[model samples]
Target chain A: EDKVVQSPLSLVVHEGDTVTLNCSYEVTNFRSLLWYKQEKKAPTFLFMLTSSGIEKKSGRLSSILDKKELFSILNITATQTGDSAIYLCAVALGGSEKLVFGKGTKLTVNP
Target chain B: SAVISQKPSRDICQRGTSLTIQCQVDSQVTMMFWYRQQPGQSLTLIATANQGSEATYESGFVIDKFPISRPNLTFSTLTVSNMSPEDSSIYLCSVRQGALTDTQYFGPGTRLTVL
Candidate 1:
């Protein structure tokens, strides 16, 4: 069965601290891996990684994929309270539009 | 990326009642999906709404419980029938623009609280 697993289900960190969230998946014919940040309502798209070893970055947030290991990591540098949200990782399978999502990492950044 | 909107942002419903959530996308999308997210849980795909065809539900989900409608390319609805406290969840609508490689854009989601 195709599944996505995210580690460190919950984390609390002080402002200015950096954090790393992990996601691993096992799927048939993997096509792409995506990261999303969910605040209160919908999850906003963060990054999409299709190739291994290439990092996708947006400001303080960066993510990289590893096809050989079937895992990915998202790193946030100098986090702030505004960065507190649930980080979700999803994988899309080839020939299918469905996205298998991980349980998500709830990061709470305190000032 | 597509812009999606959902109606009834939050609702308090009594048990035994039903709630229908609406999803609308700015552009015509190729695929639409309904998902359920319980408190502090991951998103689970409920069904795939196909335009001009019946919705395809996932394992452990049935059409009679979560009926879905996709009348067009950019509009769809999901109805939670015979609700219970266990059904209290965030119902999200997601859309894929062109192909399987396209990222799915999600709506704001309808927060349903069953009491």
Candidate 2:
């Protein structure tokens, strides 16, 4: 079975602090790694990392994949209350339409 | 990316009563996936809904318990049969625009609380 594991299940940080969330996976055929942020019901896309060492960023959030290490990390800088949410990491297997997901990291950013 | 919508954003149902959740995408998608999220837990994929064929269920999931129908490319439905308190969960629908490596967009989700 394909599995994705995330570190630091939950974290609380003050405003302006930086946080890093980690994700590691074990799959048969690797395709891509995806990040998402869930505030309420739906999960909004954050980034998709396919190659190693190449970073994907959006505003205060950035992510990178290390295929050799079989892991990925998401970094949030200058955090704000609005950044409080569950961050999810998912890996897509080659030749499959399903996504294997990590348990996620619940981030609480206090102002 | 696609705009996805789910019906009955939330509901409280009695044990043994079944519920059918609907998912609609703004555009035609080749692949639609169903997932379940229990309280304080991550999402678990249930099945992949094909546009003109039967839904492909994952391990530990069965057609009798979670039947799915994809009448067209833009719409699908998932029915939770013989429900119990254990079946209470947040059900979500997602779509992949192009290849399997493409980003998946999720619906608002149906929150079902079985009592």
Candidate 3:
């Protein structure tokens, strides 16, 4: 079975704190890894990491993947209350486009 | 990126009833997928709906319980049959565009509450 595991199921931090969320996967024919921020019902796309040792960044958020170890990490710098949301990690298989998702990390940013 | 929309943002249905959720894409797409996220759980792929063929369901999901239709590239529907309290969940619709590595854009989702 394809599996994706996320650490620290839930986290609470004050504004301006930096947080790191982790995701480790075991998939067959791995293709790519993706990160999404879900505030409500819809999950918004964040990053897509296809190569190892490379980092993808968007403003205060950045992510890196380590294919050898089959894991990825999402880092948030100076988080604000607006950054409070569920961060989801998913992996795509080579032959199939379907994504296998992790349980997700629920982050709470207190003002 | 594709703009996806789902009908009936939410619904409260009685047990033994069925509800069909519709998903519409702003542009043409080759693959559309249906997913279920139970309260406090992660999203689980229900099936993959592709035009001109029957939907391919994931393990633990069957066509009879969650029938899907993808008559065209831009639209699809998922019908949940015989609702039970256990069936209460958020149904999400997603579409894959461009390449296999491309991100799948999702709809706002339908929140279903079965009583």
- The local lDDT score (0 to 100) that residue B86 gets in candidate 1 is 96
Candidate 2 clashes between residue pairs 3 or more apart in a chain or in different chains? none
lDDT string, candidate 3, A1-111, tens digits: 899999989999999999999999999889999999998999999999999999999999999999999999999999999999999999988888689999999999999
Task: Give the CAPRI rating of model 3.
Answer: high
Expressed as tens digits, the lDDT of each residue in B21-113 for candidate 1 is 999999998999999999878999999999999999999999989999999998999999999999999999998877635588899999999
- 1 against 3, candidate with superior DockQ: 3
Q: Tell me how each candidate scores on DockQ against the true complex.
A: 0.81, 0.86, 0.85
> How far does residue B88 in candidate 1 sit from its true spot (Å)?
0.7
**CA lDDT of each candidate?**
0.94, 0.94, 0.94
Model 1: how far is A47 from its true place, Å? 0.8
lDDT, residue B113, candidate 2: 95
Clashes of 3: 0
